[model samples]
Target: ARPDVILPESSLLNLDGVQDAKLHPSLGGFQSLYDEGELAIVQNVGYPEQNFSHFRSTDIWMTGADTNELLATGWLGRYLNNQYPNYPAAYPNEDVPDPLAIELGYNLSVAFQGPVSGMGMVVGDPEWFYRLVNNIDAPVPDTQAGDKLRYVRLVTKQSQVYGEVIKNAASKITQQGGYPDTELGEQLKIVARLIAGGLQTRLYMVSLHGFDTHDSQVLNSDHTKGEHANLLATLGDAVRAFRSDLKGLQIEDRVVGATVSEFGRRIISNASLGTDHGAAAPMFIFGKHVEGGILGKNPVIPETPDVEDNLGWEYDFRSVYASLLSGWFCTDSSTLQETINKPHEILPIINPSVCGTTSSYENLYAAESWVRNYPNPVTDVTTIEFKGTGKPIRIDVINAQGQIVETIIRAKVGAGTHQITWDASRLTSGMYYLNYHNGAIHQSNALMKH
Candidate 1:
């Protein structure tokens, strides 16, 4: 089934911006991804008590913090560090062959910040990345702005860590053909090639801009032939080309792409046929393993909206972040919660083939993975063992729905064998996920509470 794209009502004919626009069907590229069951539309997703300021909203999204609180580290960066502790330090090792995450394009994002330091590598293209890596000067400027960017500039130069590997990968893979000549297409093409060459990077960050359509959103006569239309078409074209390239490269299953913005435009158009900053917009999630569906029904268009009127949030954007961490990356509930610093529901977005227990992703874990729980269905108590990296170890009992049922331990534990006895007699009899966090690494197993 194709996506349902509600076209903007004809700009000239629109008496009030609140009138429901005629359906134009969903974008072609997205429609294809949807029909193939490789896309999920999370509608009306954003933070609560919205702020219209682009910088503030962007900061909120990047840090995954509450609109009121300020957090410096990025959620994705924390997750990657969880998988490979002491990143950029333990990195470039034979066990870990590539940078854990790569940020494409020039958009300096806060989404990849890790504690102590940001853990991802920044690159433009294969050639440009090499040039920057080779010619890096380490002395950071002495200023507030310099201190803020000091970490990013430092990590950007760490290309030496994965430079050879990336170069080798780019040399081996050849893109199939027909990518739009747009900036987004160029970035995605590089990403696809690197993944095909086996970079083993856990996360790839890229973005598309030009969505801040205030004026000339749509043509006066044709609802779909203006600035906004052109942006959508460019995005659709880029996505289609990238999808085809991934298919040709045979690495489509290993990667997933998502779109994010600080805030969406208002529900109503102004006299200039443009929308003001609004709240609760739609986000697109695409991957070979995604379960495609319209997250919910079309957003109920409130009749008679105002400048302040906007779509009510259905799912918090952090919920989608949680989904990517746990469902796609198989991050345990405890680490995932810790990374976001907020409890958010992990959606059933990915197909069971990749998200279920006994999935192939389990093979990616370290050999010294935590021991399994004993007394399969614990009537009174269950015992488990784990090896810590001399860091804080957090053991949590997570219910089937991915909620933390109990906190068995939360203090720092030493290396070697540490046994834990979980008292689950009081809990209801059902399956649960036992999440263990040893330093930056996380491991989980299924436990039955009987």
Candidate 2:
């Protein structure tokens, strides 16, 4: 699920004991670098039951009725398309560009793609982006046909210049201070720079790869270090550094970061001393807006051996997404339903009983609401209940920002007290919310599990 702040490949680090391990590569010396006040060790956000087979093909993940319908345009894409309907397309070539003479970039990713004239900017080297903007007037070099070799040289030079421009844009990105040298760190640095530069970007997207750790994952004499551990260390350092950088700039309140992957590694270590393909993985969110604690009920890591070689899921991944759409973005529940395309309200819009009350209603706290899992997180069964006037009601689970996760109820009932249990043995772990509504009243509450 998408949130203001996300760490797609976050690690569960021991922030307190890392100071003395500064020289250790495997540990990454996190405690030595960050203050306890700044670090939070969150567990159970990953998909314990991840299925690797499903990740090999985008179609498998994107075409499934349950998965595809939940994520039609991606969280960022939908937000941008809806926020700025007039923003230029990601791609609008001259020959292929519409008669309207619109200029566009290449493929559109909902995170960086927006309809607002200047609501977002692709994070690149500062000098390069500026060069592209200024070089719009630069003329293409011309050479006589008899001197074909000269023309080839010119083209090569131009290409090099273009490459340089891109690099410079990425390098020249300037913020007040604090940026890690890692790839994802650099990208985030650029994001902070853009925000400081008044780019007005409301949604940002960045990624870190190398999480497919399938071999040699232990720190033994025979095995140097696990691929998974190293990757996790980098992730921890980069994210911590990014958070520091954002705080230094005083823009932490205005921005959030979240991370996702196609899927997660298998729970059971493989014969090769590494994990294999699995279903459901963890996702992380970071920011002042985040509820800085673990969410979701932890899935049971089965001790009983099985051929599947993976842990089970406690909550559906879609529930996390649904929370983002409805909660953080402040989008209408109905509109979100159309985008997600699942039946039943995935998120609760208004507290059904509180809707008519005069008592001051507080905005849901991002951290507090998400910090605790209710009925405990479940792997096989989850109970959904509603209390109020006897009426037909529907219940839905949404993620932090209000994207629907799953519809728990849809039928009418002579409602005095009603409860439904979800067979979520096949879902992932993350924060989710339950929305309950009758034709006349609406309500929402947070749900969490590992």
Candidate 3:
């Protein structure tokens, strides 16, 4: 059987800008592109307590317990390593060793580095890879036959075998139908082809970089529409295309795709009108098995400037990871907790049983409604607005999965436009929902805490 998972880098799960009418027009056609897919806007997957500014200052990316204790071994890596120990030994020559181990300085990805012969392939530019693999030459032995000649033959044989494997893989991919031209897009296409070809690969890894949108992030004429938008568009197209291609091959149901990033940017716009390093960003999960629609409580950005110039964290990120591990992968919650070195309640697993079923948005009371946030996908303090007859009003921040992170207000007030400020000076950049309750009625609106 093929690997059931596909993980990519730097992906945004639920962006409000992509959903709004005014903002949608700005994103080209990417808006509403994946509205029907199984979408989970995971809030705060990174450590919220740590100061990211200091960490980024030193260029120390991915240093949390979840990242470091795993020793550069990602959750997927650990899974692979556990499943196949001899996997590293399958790379043609015993002397060559697994490239993952070599690249990470002998520390293997937790998912792929296992005890058994874990068969895998690192998909890249086929032409470049072929050129590098086939053009290798080693000095011939001084004598016709000896220890030297035997070693040379062994090396040549291994190279030839691996070369043939690469060529076959590339040829098969070329002959297959439907793939995008972008890097990650093509990589995914290759992944699909491999799966269709019955490669028996259990874990597939690909990446999409260039998400650090520091300057010129707006879509105006003078300033360039940041790279983030283009990257996301490509990602959306690639994923959708991959899904379609999978359907054509009749294996779409067996595959699941996930995306993550190192961290999200601050809530407030920087001097350059761009975002800087901040805590807790969003994560996305897409597949036939995923429980569709928004989940979790949305976090609210205080509409006041904080001393640190950042937004507050509403949801802990580990909850999302726990959901994926326990729900999608069928791993025990306790085991996942131990692996990530953090203990949080496991979110309700998103399985086929719950797919397509609509869950109530946490604050769905009927009667008076209040809206304290506007222009979601907010770049600064969001103004919380309220409406309805005089009643006690309470505002709460919830993540995508319907988990409440913080309560902004919890008191009765006269019906009118009372403003609550969300200064996002301490939060991670991600999508969130705002819920307002006035005892008798409830209203909820989607907001982006980026």
Candidate 4:
């Protein structure tokens, strides 16, 4: 039997608060993008019965397969497979000169793993790729694994060809403003330059890591702030700055950006004050051509769950991909249906008219919350343990008749688990409510006075 690894049975606090803000304060940069209609927010997104492991879940996402199935060809790879038939031999011709896809900050992902061979390249940096490809001159292979070596050689050969072209394009443009000096910002900065310099690359993938916040997610007694805050800030700043840079270069209309994660943390916080992997999180889509708005409602967080399935299941992730393919890239529904092995409904996330008869995509990044007050049946005084946003939060104590008894808390709170002592020595013994209200989040905890 799995014991309660997080909260005790007497869990209390009041974090279900009204949320009016699109993002947390730490993510202010992203908020600006949303205001400009450059962000489309899709909340509560996940596959049905989502897998929790990082590797398996990422594989499922990349290859567009269910947890029980495995696909050698990636969803994107299948798309490219159709784009360039007889790919390896027919590619590098006049019609297909540049690489079809480019990935930054990692090796080739399964997203580009084609049926025969992967149909993409991974360049950590344009300049570095230039030097590496230019310097390499491997002699003809004399090994028995001739076919495999030849494939390897072909990848290298293409890398060399792309290296010079990418390098030249990168040199022609520079990022304009507001980019954080962080890894995500740097990688996105490279993407902006390459795009501005006239690289007709259809698919480019960049990454930001460290979303696996299993323990110490927030500071002790201050659940509002911690490692997750910094990560969210980095994301906000990177995307905002990248968009600004693109607009400055007058190419903002040509690109769209989507932010996705493999899974969301469970509603219940673990004993270490962090969350376990769960299903149905949010996805962010940003671009000038986006039909900016919230695609669906936020995932409903339950008070207590007997099973992981208690977490709400919402828009499957494949729907987002289908919309992007059919509406954004103008790919037909039949092709996407065949490639993904599912007839995922189009989400209407992209602006159809932006790219001249293309098909149609909100940014909401608020922190998750928890609360617990011990000694519920107290005689005189009681203590409330509240998990809140990193910014200032307002806690109100109300009597049974829906009148404010007292304003218990109103201040900027740090990250992690927090506690507040509430003295109800003056009020008559009766039922009451403890309410927590941040800018957009609103929640209440019922209190029994003895």
Indicate the residue-level lDDT of 323 in model 2.
49
Candidate 1 lDDT over residue span 1-450, tens digit each? 001222544422221122432223326666667667777877767665677888998989998988779888888777777877886675678787787788886644788888867777778654575454355444667998878687786665563566777777777765465788888788888888788887778778877778887777777776657777788777877888898888888877788888889988766677776787887788888888887766633554433434545565646688788777777777776787788786554556767667565322222334345757788767887787766667777777755333566888888877777887767788876556566755434445566666
Worst 10 residues of 1 by lDDT: 14-23
Q: On a 0 to 1 TM-score scale, where does candidate 2 land against the true structure? A: 0.57
Candidate 1 vs 4: which has more lDDT: 4
Candidate 1 overall Cα lDDT vs. reference?
0.69
Q: lDDT of candidate 3 vs native?
A: 0.52
Worst-scoring 10-residue span by lDDT in model 4 = 9-18
Candidate 3, residues 138-172, lDDT tens digits: the string is 45556756667868757755664444544454455
For 192-231, candidate 4 gives per-residue lDDT tens digits of 8788988878899989888788777776754446767778
Better of 2 and 3 by TM-score: 3
Candidate number that wins on TM-score, 1 or 3: 1
Local distance difference test scores for all models: 0.69, 0.46, 0.52, 0.70
Arranged by TM-score with the best first, the candidates are 4, 1, 3, 2
lDDT (Cα, 0-100) at 420 in candidate 3 = 66
lDDT of 2 by residue, 221-326 (tens): 4343566566766776777777777778777767655556666555556666666555545555555555443344444444343334333343344445554555
TM-score pick, better of 3 and 4:
4
Deviating ranges (above 4 Å) for candidate 1: 1-26, 125-159, 358-450
